[model samples]
Every structure is written in structure tokens, then in C-alpha cells.
Target: MTSTQETTRPRDIGGSPGHWRRMRMWATAHAVDDFYQGLVPAAVPYFVLERHFGYVEASGLALAATLGGALPQVPIGLLADRHRLRWMSPLGISLAGIGAGLSGLVPAYPLVFALLLTAGVGIAMFHPPAGRDARRAAGGSATAMSYFAAGGSVGFFVGPALATPALDTLGIGATALFIPPAVLMGLVLLRHHDRTPGATAEKVRRHGTDQPGRFAALTSVEIVRSTISTGVNTFISLYWIRHLGAGSGLGGTALTLELGGGVLGTLLGGRLADRIGMVRTVQLGNAAMLPALWLMLACDDKYAALPLALLVGLISNIPFAVLIKLGQDYLPSRPGTAAGVTLGLAMSAGGLFMPLLGVVAGHYGPRGALTVLATVPVIAILLSTALREPVHEPEPPRATPSTTHDRHR
Candidate 1:
């Protein structure tokens, strides 16, 4: 078929009846995949408590998962771009669940680390193909992509919430209970792919030139945003307790509020991006973060700062889904790679900077650590200045029948 014909083929349109159904499927799959990632941190304390692991050993398990998830995504994405990998999503999630679930069943520290690492790889394998397909299913709608992003956020929250109680009641082995969701979700996704004709053969044919430079700039902005998020989430509670003189319960409440605000912000960002354009939406989010964070830090009363904490989370995360969508737009030919770097690598890279922030916190307190974090948005704003809206090249003109006949002759 001609390029024009291919371009105009019937496909899922954004906001259509079937669009939401497909989006929900992808989002739910994403949640299942990321849940195992969330389980690692939730299960870490149990490892220490039950296994009598040292702090360093417990940290190693987290590191194992982090390394496994982060390091392989780009390569996996490249593979996804080159071939149809419909099975990756379901298989990846199942591996994630199996690795995490089995970790608690074993007694050896190395076994736990290996299992977590295996789960991390599973998470890695899931993102590229799933993200690529999800973007296609989203029909280039940023608002739709937000639903997908929000799924991962919700998964992270649910993982800890459900696992904590199970661990508390049944000891560490309760992690086995979390396995069913992954298996069940995997089966659902697998069935969906199998039943949908041509689903495995669908490809994103590129029309525009790939903008690696713009994608890189966007990645930088995301990295900065990720760093800021990590810093705030890591230190906000401590800042509340130590600096604002709030009790421990109030400090935890502050963290919860921040996280809840993030979910809202992700959804809001998608809608805003659709209305105002992704670049402007991202710039606005970064610009707004400056004042929101400064006000939160300046507040003396913990109670008053609680709302500010929510505002900070909201503003900081408003660009979250926007960046993801923009990255795919910038590199249309390699949506899988864009998703891998933006969704996985940037986040992991951002967390790697925490030791520096931790040192700052150690010497100057959580306030000092957060004070350093407050300046991070400026970097994102600067990087965003280099980004331009991706322009999709128009499809080539249709060939005349006479021309086709002549060419064949």
C-alpha cells in the first residue's frame, strides 16, 4: 500500500468509544507491572526484620532491582522498535511478579537479591513494548497517556498499602499473595493481544524526521524533574518533623498528601497539555514550581505547610505525563526508546543523585536538603527552552493509476 493509504488507515482515534477501553487495558497492565517494583521497598523492612539483614544488605536488594530495571530498558526499547513484541508486556509482568513473590519464600540474601533483580528485568522488558503500544492506543493524545501514567502511580501506592498489611499479618511470606495480580493481568493482556487480529503486526510507521536533539533536551528536563521529585519525597517528611516541629504522624501525613497531589497533577497535566500544548504546559509547570516550593519551605507552621506540600507535589508533577508524550512525539520513529528513557532511565538516574542530597541533609538537615532541591526546577525550565513542538510530516501524495501502470511496465 502507498504511504498515504497507510497513513489514512482506520485506527483507534483519541476519545473514541474503543479508545478508552484500550487505554484502560494498557493502564491496568502498567499498574500490574509496576506493582512489583513498589513491592521491593515495602518488603525491604521485612527483610531486615525477619532475615536480620544489615542496612547495607537491605539497600542491596533495592539496588539489585533498580539496576535490573534501569540498565536494560533502552536496549529492550530498541528491540521493540525493530520488531513486534506483543508478548513482552504479559511476559514481563509475570516475571516481575514471580521474581518478587518468590523472594520472600527463600531464606538466602543472595537469592532474594537475585529474585528482585530478575523482577527488575521483568519491569524493564514490560515498558518499551507496552509504552509503545499504549502511545499508539492513545492516538497521540496527552490526556490519554496521563491515564496510563496515573496507573503506574496508583500501582506504586497500592503495592505498599496492600503488602504492608499482608506482611504485618502473615510475615514476609505474604508477598506470595501479591503474585496473583501479575499472573491474572498478564493473562488478560495476553488474551487481548491474541484475540485482536493484526494486533501483533501493528507498526508505527514514521513520517517525520527523528529529533534526537530535542528528545535529549526533553530527557534532561525529565531527569531534573525526577531528581526534584525524588528529593522532595525523600526529605519532605523529615523537613516537616525536624524543621517545622511537627509530630511523626503529621510528617507521614504530609508525605501522603504530597503523593495524592501527584496523582491529581498527572491527570491535570495531560488535559492542560492537550489544551495549551505540551511545551507550554511543561514550561508553566516548571515556572510554577519555583513559587510553590519556596512558599512551602518558607512556611513556619506545619499545618499551613501541609497544603503547600500538596501544591508543590501538584506543580512538580504537572509536567510528568507531558514529558512522556513529548518524548514520543519528538522521536516518532522510536517511541519505544523514548518511553524507555523517559519512563525508566530518567527516573532511575534521578534517584542516583540522592546520596548527594543525603549528604546535604546530614550536614544541614532536611531543610537544607530541600533547599537544594528547590533550585532544580530552574534547570528543567532552561532545558525546556530548547524543545520545540514536533511537526509530523505530511503523507506523500497518492500515485496516479496511470503512473502505477507505467512504473510497473
Candidate 2:
């Protein structure tokens, strides 16, 4: 490429402190999307009975909260690729907050569901752009996305914890109280929206123009793996609770432990992939899951279940960061779309298969259902056919300490 071409290409520069800060900011803006939806599964049934609404309507409300937030991810992702995502993140949060804040204010059924659907739209809009930015902000590493993804897990945990208390303190009618903090953050985002030197903007713009073919290639396989992973998680929760005689509290504990494991696994896995290679890290994580499968299937003790579940979660999520990073490497031009589709759509598509899982569960019982999900990692091991090591040559062999000029960068 010529000098003009080198200057024109948008190279990734996400490893710097400035980029991590941006990732954190995007994380906070998108937290609102996680908070309420996570709260919905617990609240939706209550909304039906307490309000004397029909079960179908309440279930519809629940589905809207979930799939609505996930369904439109790709379209929004593509748009954010072309524009600054600053306002989009905040606006989506504010809209969801408005819907959630007003959720308890109304007495009518139609309006309540309508507002939730609206809330769902906001979440859908918010995630793709913000997630894409996280992929970019991660500065081309799996560890970066780990930090970014952990924020959502934390937000989800907070949602139910906060909502349960808020219900008692403010009552459902006063849920609007939750909106203030989010709104204030949106305002702050507007004020702090990046207005850096044109050179920095020029660099980011150039990075956005990298190879699209690579991104789509990784995205295709990631979509399949992600879908399988989501199915596994959703079923595990249901099977353990219903058939294993685990209580709601235990189920929550299991899920949280799994999430915490995922956070750690992602961090370690990404760094390992960086040191070794993506395929190695991916294979190691998936293969490590085999023992966790034994524990999950055989262990009946509640305490035993928790730690095993945690290990399972770790193995499940370890591959995630690598997939997101690879997607960006493949499709240099649309990192956000790459991350959003796999994380959002592939995940949702996975959950969408729960009905089939339910059928299998009915035939073999809950234990059998969980076994089905545990089997999916085996498929992931097989589907990893497309994976290849990143093209960057391994760092050269080190010389003697006295002779080597060890510059870390």
C-alpha cells in the first residue's frame, strides 16, 4: 500500500487507557438494558397474578422483554457501524428507563405490555452498538471483551436484587424511581461524548474500513456456537431447579456462580489465547468441560452442584472472548456488527431452541434435558473447523537477559 493508503486505513488502537475508559462508559450506558430485562422473568408472573391479568398476556410481556431486546440487534449494529455510537447508547437506555419507570404507573393491561415492548426496543437498540464498541475498545484482545461482558453479568445480577427491594420499598406503582440514576448518566454521556483531535477520529474511521471477509467468516461459526451455548445455559437453570429439587435460591446461586466463573474463565482464556493461539485456547476450554459434565450429571448434593455449576460456566464462557476478537479480525470494517450478532442474535437463537429442549426433557426427565445441553460442547469441539491461528507470527525467541533489549511493546 502507498503512503496515502497507510494513512487512510483505520487500524485498531484499543489497548490504550483512553479506549478502556470508553469501554467502561459504554458499559455503564448499556447497564440499563440488562437491569430491567433480568428483573422481568421474576416480575412478569407477579405482574399477571397481582394485577389479575391473563397468563398468556403476562407471558407475552415476558417474551417481549427478552426477544424484543434481542431481535433487532443486527440492524442496529449495522447502523452504529456508520456513525458515532455515543448518543445511541444513552438514548436507548433512556427509552428503556422510561418504559420501565412507567411500568408500574399504569393500571391497564394493554398499556403495560405496550410499555414493556417499548422497553424491549430500547434494549435491542442499545446492545448492538455498545457491544460493537466494546469489541473495538477491547483493543483487539479477548481480555478486553471479558471486562466489557462482565459488566452485563453484574448488571443482570443487580437487576433482580434491586428490583426485589424496590418493589417492597416503592411498590410496583412507584418503579419510576429507578429511572433517575440512568437518566443522569445519559446526561453525563452527552456532556462527555468524545470530541478528541481529528487525528484520533481519523484513526478510528480508518480502522472501520478493514477487511469485511474475515469478520463474516468468524461470525458464521460464532453464530452456531453461541446459539448452542445459550441453549445450554437456559436449560441448565430449568432442569436443575425443577427436577433436581433445587430451590429458587439455589438456582439463583447456581446461575450467579456460573456467571462469576464465566468472568474469570473469559479473562484467563483470552490472555491464554493471546499468548498461545485462538484454536488452542478454544480447544482447551471446551475439552476441560468434560469433567464438569461428570460432576453436573452425577452430583446430587446442593453444595456440590454450586461449585460444579461454576466450573461449567467457566468452561462455557471461556471461548466467548476469542470468538468476538476473531470476528473483528475477520471483518475489520464492522466490529460492532460482528460482536453484536454473535453475542446477541446467536445467543437468542440458542434460547429460541428451548422448546425442543423442553420436549426432550419431557421424554427423559430434567436430568436428561441437562445432559442434552452438556452434550453441546462436544458439538462446539467439532464445529471449530473454521478456526485457524491469527496470522501474526509468534514473537521471536528471547536471547540472554544481558543481551536482550526486552521492550514489552
Candidate 3:
């Protein structure tokens, strides 16, 4: 399959607009499924404490969810490349819903971790398919994938907020857990009925522009730097609660501030890209983290931690939107693989680094961890320097009749 064919303006199944609209619906459905998988960490501690698991065991459950959810992106990307997105996306959503519902019902600690792992696998399955389908519908621009990624963030916020209240009041059997995925799957199937066909091989693009070779190393750099910054932000929230004696309300406020910053970043970063280019925007986003991290690290007062957490959240999330957009341009033909690797594999790296982070916290405390995380933006700044700006072909100018006559004369 030609690479150009792979990117040919996305046409509807019937060669119309309705197909793109319908596909967006499925993209959203699958994104929410991914969101819940991301949310398990925020809710699992309560589950563990309420269920009588020790702190270590509870942390284990949380860790399992990320590991399972994150590690399978490469295989899933290949599968999505090889197959149809419609069925794969819905099936993944259904599995994630089932996993969330079942996690609450299981009796053993190991069983709970297993449910979380299954939930992660479901998340891994959904993203590549949803992303690829969205690209197909949205006309293969960075804007398309950015919008697609935003849905996952919405899910991430909703999952924790929705689950916390339910589990707090109703001991994990809350039917709401099952409702999200089931409703989404049913909705997608109803909307996209009888339209899903097995994916045919796309003609590979003959142009050298389609393949990203050394760019993989650059993507790896992005993965590590983003993951490290995120891990530090997670640590900051806990640090505030512990060291500053901040209540849950204050910690939640800090988290909210971070999320709000992400919304702002997503909205504005694209314009920044158009004006200054992808490289400058990425550098600015990462550089913004330095002062934000410094503020959090210097604050020893109780009142200061909330704003510090807010700062960390703000700086950490903006770059998130930027990096995902950059990932696709780095590998335009395999945006799905890029999503899986940058968002998937690198997240596991973030998870893998936690043990060392924990030691940093244990020996030097959370403030030291923040300091370490502060270095990530510096690293990202360096990594982004190596990226070549993606070449975008400009539209041709219209020819004037007067010019034609002059040339003929």
C-alpha cells in the first residue's frame, strides 16, 4: 500500500460526511474506555484499604493496572494496522467495562490485580484502533489526533471522580461501574451497524517522507521525559498531603488545578504551533515546568503546597498535549504505533522508575523527588532540539488570466 494512499483525504464508507461523523462517535467511545483504565490509580487505594489489603499490596494493585495497560501498545498497534478498527475498538471498550465491574466483585488481592491487568490490556487495545479511525475521519492532521487524545483526558478525570463517590457510598458493587462502557459499546454498535469490514492493506507510500527511522530514538526521549515529569507530579500530590498535612479537599483542589491547566494547554498549544512551529512550542511547554517545579520544591509552608501542586499540574499537563501531537508528526504513517509507544511504552517506563522514586522519597523525602522531576523538562528541552520540523506542503497559488496572455505574447 502506498503511504500517500494511507493518508489520502479520509473518505466516508459511502463517500460522504456521515461516515466521518459516525467514526468520531466510535473514537469517543473507545477513548472513554481508555480513560477508565488510566483512572484505576486514583480509586484503587480506597478499594485496598476497605478490602483489608496492606499498603504494599494496595500499591501493587495500582501498579499492575499501569503495567498491563501500558506494556501492550506495540502489539496492539500492529494488530490495528493489520485489521479493522470498528470491531476491535468496541470489543476493547466492552472488555474494559467488564474489567472495572469485575474488579469490585473479586475477593482476593491477586484476583483484583488480575482484573486491573485485564482492564489495562483492554485500554491498550482500544487506543490504537480509535486513534487510527479518528485519523481516517479527521483528514490526517495533528489536529485530528489532538482532539482524539482530549477525549481520553476527559475519561481520566471522570473515572476517578465517578468511582470515588460510588465506592465511598456503596462498597465497590456500584452499577455505575458497568454503565459507562456498556452504554458506549451499545451506542457505537447501533450507530455503526453492519459497516465494519476487515481492513485491507493500504498501499505503502513510495516517498521517503512516510517512514521514521532514527526518529524512533527521539520518540523514546519524549516518552521518558514526559513520564518522569508526570511521575513527579503524582509524587507532589502525595507529598503535599503528607508533609504539609493538607486534607483530601486541598489535594483534590491541586489535582483539579493541574487538569484545568491541561485544558488550557490543549486549547492554546496548537495556535502556538502554527505561529512558531512544533519545536519552539514543545520547548516552551517543557521550559514552563522549571519554575513550576521550583515553586513546589521551595514551599515548606502548609498553605504553599496547594498552589505548588497546582503549579506542577499546570506545567506537567500542557506538555502532554504538545508531546502527543508531536508524536504523530514524528511518524505520520504509523500514528497508532507512535501513540502506543509514546503514550503506552513510555508510561511503563514512568511506572518502572517509581521504585527508584520511592527510594528517593524514603531517603531524602518527596521534596527531593520534585527536584529530580524538575530535571525532566531540561532533558525534554534537549531531546526536542534533535527533532526536524515536519515539512507541510503549502497550497499552490491560483493563476490569473492576465498572466497567461502576457506569457503567450
Backbone clashes in model 3, listed as residue pairs: 1-202, 1-203, 1-204, 2-203, 2-204, 2-205, 3-204, 3-205, 69-120
Q: Give the per-residue lDDT of model 3 (tens digit) for 1-409.
A: 3333435543212223442353466446745775676457656766766788888888888778777777788888777666555566676677677776788787788888898788778777777766665655444443444455556666765667667777778876662366466556746754563564322223111111543753565576667665665576477566667777787777676676666556555545544554566567777777787887777767777675666665666555555545665665566666667667766676567767777888888887776776788776777777767776666443223236686467546
Cα lDDT tens digits, model 1, 1-409, are 4323433343322344444575899888888898887888889999999999999998899899999999999999899888777798899999999999999999999899999999999999999888887776676678788889888877876787788889999999999998888988989999987875543223353545788999989989988998999889889989999999999889988987887788889888888887778899999999999999999989999998899988988888899888888898888788888889988999788889998998999999999999998888889889899989778666445557787678648
lDDT of 2 at 208: 38
Give the Cα-based TM-score of candidate 3 against the true structure: 0.81
Top TM-score model? 1
TM-scores for every predicted model: 0.91, 0.81, 0.81
Off by over 4 Å in 1: 1-19, 199-205, 396-409
lDDT of 2 by residue, 98-200 (tens): 7777877888888888888777777777776666556545545555565666666566667777787777665676568777866776677566566421222
| Deviation from native of the Cα of residue 195 in model 3, angstroms | 5.7
Q: Relative to the true structure, how large is the alpha-carbon lDDT of every model?
A: 0.84, 0.65, 0.63
With a 3 Å backbone cut-off (N, CA, C), the pairs that clash in candidate 2 are 10-206, 10-207, 132-336, 214-330, 214-331, 215-330, 215-331
The list of candidate 2 runs beyond 4 A from truth reads 1-22, 168-171, 195-217, 220-229, 232-238, 390-409
Please estimate how well model 3 matches the true structure, expressed as its whole-model Cα lDDT.
Answer: 0.63
